[model samples]
Target: MTKTVEFYFDLGSPTTYLAHTQLAKICADTQSELIYIPMLLGGVFKATGNASPAVIPAKGRYMFQDLDRFAKRYGVQLRFNPHFPINTLILMRAATGIQLHQPQRFAEFVDCLFRALWVEGRNLNDPQTIAAVLTENGFDPEEVLALSNDESVKAKLKENTEAAIKRGVFGAPSMFIGDQLFFGQDRLDFVEEALRQD
Candidate 1:
């Protein structure tokens, strides 16, 4: 039987960026179907009473160091965004809109936004900056913005967030192989193993 991995993610997460780098290769290796579910990290936190590790000083310090090691190991660029904690509400809404309407461009959207925030450390919080990034990537900023603002798109994002929370997701990069939940980019090895077992 073919296996599947339901990847619930929020683009705001640096760890989710790391997971983005590896999950594709793992899925290809295992021949598993990868489904991307864009969710709101802030919403997840609010619903589950969980907070980012960055809320803690020492843990945040150690988290970055650990992330750097993983990035090197994975050979992916993961620079610290000066604009850490990007309000991903709109970004994720845009992503979800793209995923829903322009499925072909979904991967491009993910790559562009993830690279902007995580690799190039671009500040996505600014509207002009986001527009510029979209233009540079051959995306129509006005169209994307309009799509994001659609009531259905907004409601879909909310629904996705709620569904993720209901599925025991409290953070970004939560992967589910069937009923098993594997949270965090660090748990990807287990994800691969799970796929193999299936």
Candidate 2:
């Protein structure tokens, strides 16, 4: 049986970047289909009474070191973008729009965006930067940007975020196998286990 897993993500999250970096292997091993669900983490947090890990004193302190260790262990480059906690609304909307228009292009664009933010310290909120990233990824930047602001695309982004909140998603990189929700990059092992059982 082919298992289907829903991946809820927001680009502002480092953990989401981490999960994106590692999920391909798990999907290959388990033969599970990944249903990409992009949502605004800010909306999820507001609706679910949740906050970022960086807001917690203890966890905030540990997260930096944890990210470093995880990066080294996974051999993934990790650059702390000066624009930490970036305004991801536009990015998420653009991504959703791209996915709606061109699925394959969406994946490539996302990979580039993630690397730009988490591996190269790029400012994702800037239009020029995002355009450069998309262009470098072989996407037509102007077309994607045009669709990004379309009413329908904007509506999808809003709907996705609202649905995520209603689904009890309070953070980034959350995976859902049916109704079982696994939060965090560390919880991906559990997500794989759930897929195995399925």
Q: Write the per-residue lDDT of candidate 2 for residues 1-198, one digit (tens) a residue.
A: 688789999888998999998888888899989888889899888888889888887998799789888889888999878888799888888899989988877788789889999998999888898888888878887888788888999899889888887887888888888898898888887988988883
What's the TM for model 1?
0.99
Best by the lDDT measure: 1
lDDT by residue (tens digit), candidate 1, 125-170: 9999999999999999999999999999999999999999888999
Q: Model 2 scores what on Cα lDDT? A: 0.87
Q: In model 1, what are the clashing residue pairs, if there are any?
A: none
The local distance difference test score of each candidate is 0.95, 0.87
lDDT of 1: 0.95
Candidate No. with top TM-score: 1
Q: Which segments of candidate 2 are over 4 A away from where they belong? A: none
Candidate 1 weakest ten by summed lDDT: 189-198
